[model samples]
Target: MELNYVISITDRDQIQELAALFQSLELNMGLAMLGKGTATSEQLSIYGLSNTEKAIVSTVADGESARQLFRAAKRKLFMDIPGNGIMLTVPIKSVGGGRTLAYLTGNKTPAGGAPDMNFEHELIIAVLNEGYSDAVMDAARTAGAGGGTVLHARGTGTKQAEKFFGVSLAEEKDILYIVATAQQKAAIMTAINKTTGAGTKAGAICFSLPVSQVIGLRKMDDN
Candidate 1:
């Protein structure tokens, strides 16, 4: 009875293949966008990644379905391979308004229960001034982050944001999506704070969402 948000990021060429997999799992309602990874050359070499071009696929899935897709991704997409890709799911606190929620759940009313915050994985989302994704990723790497996907996005409520911060909140914003273990979340957030926090020109705002499940992110054995 729980909803989960599933996100998959992989090489651009694999978009269709992965999408097909999602369709096979009935995760048909989704969107795909192009992005570029911000991994350093050394990092790329370490992960066996050859290109920076990426495709980010996202969908809203029920909890059980999300788990099924996660396992399929590891087996079909080679997600367990160091640099193949990463997928994660965050519990959805609530779905939609009354009717919309019912439709999504096939007439079942949303439990609307209090959200549970305890989790072992976190999704680090950082919104930064344009062109600063590399800087943010640099700090992230120093704090144990493997890599991140950068998406071109524009900010809204510029006036309110600028007034509150007393600085220009550029409409053009770059969003960095980084997933890390719960134990490493604090360090990664700290690193981002020092480099692009409110005091800096990047005007970065960072936060974390408790992830219920993560796939393709486990460290590979040396076997």
Candidate 2:
């Protein structure tokens, strides 16, 4: 059995509906977080998006179930339509312990074999000081990134982080998620690090995760 971490980003108003959809799929252990779209006013206008508030829902599922959830979301929520939302699956490479693995997989037989790492798209996650998202996105765009979703967050281990980095660390943070083609991932990450890295005022750290599948990116693809 192969496992994947599925994430859906949509309007905050759709949280209830999205939760219901997840229930129908028996993905009851899902979690939801509040976020905002990073689209500039012009980009939002071009895409017909008015509301920037978003809800990010995540859950774990087997490979087949993950595909089913994507199909259902497209049909019922019109996620395939531009500006509706986006969904992506990151292949789960391993679990920490047997009990935790069983809990996540509903006690299914322990998964075997390594997950396929070959992928066309990657999820670029950048953690930055709260107000630096705009600057970071600017750098990312210059490297061929299309757009990103921003989630407001708080940092822990602030004292330790500051001690290690030798810089005052801000408690408030912003997490930016950018989906980009594998060919452009390196350039995008490099641009971000060079411009707003930990050494800079943005104090940003960027990384990438292999995405097995992605949906609701037709608009981006069209552009």
Candidate 3:
């Protein structure tokens, strides 16, 4: 079985509407995260750059479900409201992380059995440092990745430092996402870790998910 995730990045004002749109299409909202501009403001202020606000909404779903939601959004929302939003889907391999399996799919139903995220196919996931956009792209490209989305994010639970390491960590961050194949996953991660993780301070992180099924994107051409 392949698992797939539909991730949406938008401003605070659009979250509710986006949620409703997804819900209408039968995809359950799994997790939601905020994007504070504090760090961006600080970093930009240092160089006199302006700041912008954003948020991320991630949903777990099957390929058919994802396609339906995409169509709904496009027809209902027009999807080009000038910074209103962007939505995409990535394939995941497994869901053996936590109690999440049962939690995410209330029916305890498999992807095929219950539209509850049976994965339906296989895909890759890459986690990397906040700022290494270029490195992420380069590495993904090496593994047949044509493009990925950039998500503004922040680290949580920082009450630790300010003590042990004496290192004041900036909570603001950025996460780049690339969805490729089970075959391309490993190479992309290795390229990212080797170049961004080792050579730079981006502190790159990488991982993958098996995708069960997919919709649209006859153009992405997974190499």
Candidate 4:
């Protein structure tokens, strides 16, 4: 079966409802993180989003179940309506081992196949030192990125991480998520790396993921 990593971002007030929705869908292994939207006042107005705390929820599911979850979220939570939330799925290429795969997939048989690559947009994720989100967002904006979400996080094994990445890393981190068009991904990533990457105060590490499906960004698309 094809596996997908599903991510949902919504207002903090809606987290409980979203969690119950996930439970009804059997997406039990999900995690929720507190985050804040990075949109400016004007941008927030344009997107019909209020300046409120956000929740970032993620989970793994088979392709079919992922689709079902998306549909249910749209119908039950009005996720398709602007200001409700956004949901997206990224294809999972592989997992660790048999038992690991079974646990993630709920014991479904594993299958190997080429990932779908015909997506028009991708999700760019950046990990940076805490309090450096402003610098990262500034760089990203220069490369045509509109807005992003910032999640506060704590890191482990920093000593080893510093040796591997050749840069000092703090335990406190900020994970920034930017969804941009495929055409904009490279430039945004390059800009971020040049301005905030290793050796810089931000010391950011950036990467991209294929977004097989997404919703609640009609305003972005219209722009």
Query: How well is each residue in 116-158 modelled by candidate 4, as lDDT tens digits?
Result: 7779889999999999998999899999987788999887646
Tell me the tens digit of each residue's lDDT in model 1 across 1-223. 6887788888888888878887887664678988888778886677676866988998877766777888888888888676788888888887558776655545654555645779988999998888989888888989989888999887765677677775455578888999988999999999999987877877778999999887777473558
lDDT of each: 0.81, 0.86, 0.57, 0.86
Q: What TM-score, to 2 decimals, does candidate 1 have?
A: 0.88
Best-to-worst order by TM-score is 2, 1, 4, 3
lDDT score of model 4? 0.86
Clashes of 2: 0
**Count of steric clashes across candidates, in order:** 0, 0, 26, 0
Estimate TM-scores for all models: 0.88, 0.91, 0.53, 0.88
Q: After superposition, how far is residue 17 of candidate 2 from its true place, in Å?
A: 1.7
Which runs in model 4 stand beyond 4 Å of their true positions?
Answer: 157-166, 220-223
Candidate 3 displacement at residue 183 in angstroms:
2.4
Q: TM-score of predicted model 3? A: 0.53
Ranking by lDDT: 2, 4, 1, 3
Weakest 10 consecutive residues of candidate 4 by summed lDDT: 214-223
Where does candidate 2 clash, by residue pair? none
List residue ranges in candidate 1 displaced over 4 A: 106-115, 167-170, 218-223
Name model 2 segments beyond 4 Å from true.
Answer: 158-160, 167-170, 219-223
